[model samples]
Target: MVLEREILPYFQWLLGGEGLGLGALPQFGLVMLGLALLALIGSYLFAAARYGPLGGGDLVFQTVSSGFREMWEISPRRIWALARLAVKEAWRRRVVVALLVFFVILLFASWFLRTDHQDPAKLYISFVSTATTYLVLGIALLLSAFSLPSDFKTKTIYTVVTKPVRAGEIILGRIIGFSLVGTALLAVMALCSYVFVNRSLDHSHQVEEQSLRHDSLGGEVLGYQGRTTLDASHRHDVQLNNENNGQALGNHGHSHSITARGDGHVVSAAEGIMRARVPRWGKLKFKDRQGVEKELGVNVGNEWTYRSFIEGNTQGAAIWTFEEINESLDPAGEGLKIGLIVRVFRTHKGIIGEAIGGAFQVRNPETGVQSELTFFDAQDAKISEITIPRKLVGTDNSELDLFKDLASNGRLEIVVQCLQRGQYFGFAQPDCYLRLPEGSATWNYVKVYLSIWVQMVIVTSIGVAASAVLSGPVAMMLTVSFVVLGFFREFFVGVATGTEYGGGPVESLVRLITQMNVISPLEAGASTSLIKGVDAVLQSLMLSVAQVLPDFSAFSTANFAAFGFSVPTDRVLQDLTTCLAYVAGLAVIGYFLLRTREVAK
Candidate 1:
């Protein structure tokens, strides 16, 4: 329900842009600039009306222009001085008290969070990440919003304003100072949370040779009943290959894969399960029922609309084209490791937990040679790994070298399809990728925190900007409102565009008044037309607002860390750019707002 109410709308907007071949960034920028200009004009008009001609438009322009120039020429010393004062002010307001609350939560979390269920590691990671995010964000908002307003209330602002200080400098000081505080808080919390999770789930079990029995054919020692020695808390049942070595494997909740050492036995812990994976993303292509190459498949009955599903028992197929293949990249020498997260949508439940059958095939474009279809049983909502061997022997017992024969100019195609009738396989662009080993899990963990820091910066900047024109409590409320609304911007867009079940706000109100069902068409009448007209107007306004607000959910990287996936460099860069753009815009708005304020008066 939250996905539909919040996440679905933003994704729907993205899909709409993709379908229409429109660039989202340019459109977003234009809308944002337009809104900014409108706000500037509205502020100018209000100032003119309140302060009369001399103190109105002319005074506002003078103040803004002078403040802008002064801001540009402001010395680092002034900014730092104000920053230090802000830090002291935050301490005066007892912001560190929030950190104490965070500590208490971390200490008591073990009692409430059930680790006996599936994927305790994932649950722990999710809990810590969510807790730290909310706690840090709240503290940042409070500091940014109240610092300046508190100064105004105590007449301390007058002392700063009357000096050689510009309003923009004050804003910059608040943002930088509060950000430092937030950074410190977040750093401590992240470290503590990580340590807490690691210590809490620090479990290990010893495997003995007596517990393992040798298989006749493979000559490999297999653990008893596919399980190993049980510890007091938990036990690992690691699978071994023909060489009697444990293979790398993962479950939904793990932050990394677990592997056994020589002799098919090793001590395993939560920390041992984590290892960094580097993914080689490939370009995806789809073939329609008519076998024509297409960009993507048609959407199934999914409300999220993020992934497209190919019909089962049909000619439709999703193909991934991988390039730059070499033996060096495949360190294991066993084959190429492809990680896939496929969503299975079953039309009928044959049996609960019964995996559906899927097929993966490797084909050569130039030689028309293809490998045997690799059949794998895929569970719904789980990631499956399939390894493609370097050599594919044909039915005639002829060996086809994967890199030498199948690869066309070092390019290979892997096709995915659903083998079962009435069962669909859903995939997005990010669902499947080649797992290229990279940095450790600890390094990737740091990157996730960096993404959260970017979000905190944005919130702090907005809070400071709001305080430029609003009272302390009002500014805090406004900042909090922005966060809540930004998180659900897509939901507002859906309502405005009649994409939600109840249609636009006005139409929903009308339906409520007339006791009409949401799905049914309205009866033909003057009232219906009037209601529709009002709805159209309201939708247009809401749409304009939605276009300007940043989608806060886009900054979250908790899922990536929780699922043992590396946060891509491109994603981190994109988030940083987005944060900077918003901060710049808000800084400009704050400058103009603070310039017109009568701080000295």
Candidate 2:
């Protein structure tokens, strides 16, 4: 005869390991593609610098060079001349300078803010950028509009015009001058800000380092320990036999116990009569057969069987065990210990294990005592157990990473058995420290400054172009109106009150203004169904008149940058083209108006 050895079953999981299917490349490529495009444009512009117009380069330089022209020949001069003029003028303009200085201070102070917080830089950037743009645009517009107009009023243009200078060239020169002054001030501010931000980062890094050091000290000097105690409220409910899984009474006066016998057999003690059924293989037996009895609220299913061990009359609290299985009579008609199945139940307050499923054997080194126990999952209708069984041995197994996979399972949690449980859940503390940077790289700050500068230039251009065509006071009024419109124009409409289709109440007019261009033909058609009461007025305007506004929200990217949302590059290009086209068209109209009008006395 051959020897029969124990065999361990290995389950081959059919799950496919996580693999890449090319989804990652698209996201990564998009950012790389954008940076590539930016680089290409920069290179192209740099290469074409010696060529004709560097886009709109002539405007401001011409304005300043014309100021010193001899009224005879229109010849070229170094561009830096106008740049110098702007700085001198900006220095004299205390109002604008004060605002710029204040904003610079704010920028520097922003570095001190808690950068570790989510989106703080984004919020700070958006607010500061928008405000800085307004300031720069206002000052630039005021300077540019008054630049030539003031000369015209003083009749200084006649002298300058009679010289070699052209009117266009003069306007260009003034723009260049102001841009230079603005650029220098911006450069200084950027340097300071970049220094501050780097210093802040250094300080943050130092603090983190010190915190790690302190954690090491804490771990070494003041030993710590911890424990996970199950609250009495969320205890386990169980029984000893196969009948009482669901019908077990809640918090009744009853208890059950299980004991291990010397013959490697488990004896369950309950209040039911000791009955045994013979199985095909063996006869069932218990150490104490007289303890088995039935009490109250007994129910059984295939999964669980037990005596209704807890009495219905008893109160306060109690626990029990249960099982669910029947044994068949053998050929010899002898009682057998086979066919017993273990089941666990959840009570309203505690969990009960009827027949212990499997025993986790543990030994205490100090006492030299061994114990066998079975764990249950639920104690009440709502409660669930979070138990982890660990077998302790001589050497510490805590550092070993075995059984980590079992910990991830929802019900079958695994935890290490430690000599001392204190190290189980302790969090290390940190230290306090600061550090500073020692360099002059300020590219980010410069970019912020440049972005603000360009936006202001655009805004001032709009206002100046208007002022160039209108009378002084009218120009001022128009400038202020447009500026106000830029910031608060949404208030004039009712869409600010609610959504067009009552999707929800609008938080503010600003959100409504931003959505002005989100037009869909289907939406236009859908508007008819939204005709109800006073809201109908809003619907009508949204479907018709409000479409004419510049969608000041379209010009805004606050939500995109501040809220960490996508702003499609195509949309940026489209909106930028639209705004430029509109500005140009408006300026043309104003030019015609100016050309036809004679100066009033």
Per TM-score, the best of the predicted structures is: 1
After the best TM-score superposition of candidate 1, give how far the Cα of residue 458 lies from its true spot, in angstroms: 1.6
Residue-by-residue lDDT tens digits, candidate 1, 1-601: 0111222233333333545554445665776679767876886788779988667887668765786687679778888998888888878888889889999998899989876656676678789988988888898888888877888889888888888887778888888888888888899988998899778776665555565555554663443324545543455555555455552233324322235566555644545344456667677778776668888786776666777788778887888888887677677778888888788888888566678888888877667677777889876666676778888874355787777777857778888988777888887776777877657788778888888899899999999999998999999999998889888887877898888887778778877988988999888899778888888999998887777577877677777677667776766766776777778778777877787577796
The global Cα lDDT (0 to 1) of model 2 is 0.36
Query: Taking the tens digit of each residue's C-alpha lDDT, what string does model 2 give over 1-601?
Result: 0001111111111111235323322423444455446534554454357544564245324422443353334344622444365456567766456455655667566555554443343444455556555555666667655654665588654654455434334444555576665565555544544444333322100011111111125345322111111121211133222211111111211122323244222312221111111111111111111223223223422222222212121220111211211122112323212122222232322223432222222223233233333333222211111222232222333321112222122112111111111111100000000011111223333433544554554555555566555656667676666556555445444453443333222322323655643233223344434433334555555434333334443355443333222333333444444445444434333333333324331
Model 2: residue 434 alpha-carbon error in angstroms: 35
**Top model number, lDDT:** 1
Question: How high is each candidate's TM-score?
Answer: 0.86, 0.36
Clashing pairs in 1: 278-436
Alpha-carbon error at 364 in model 1, in Å? 2.3
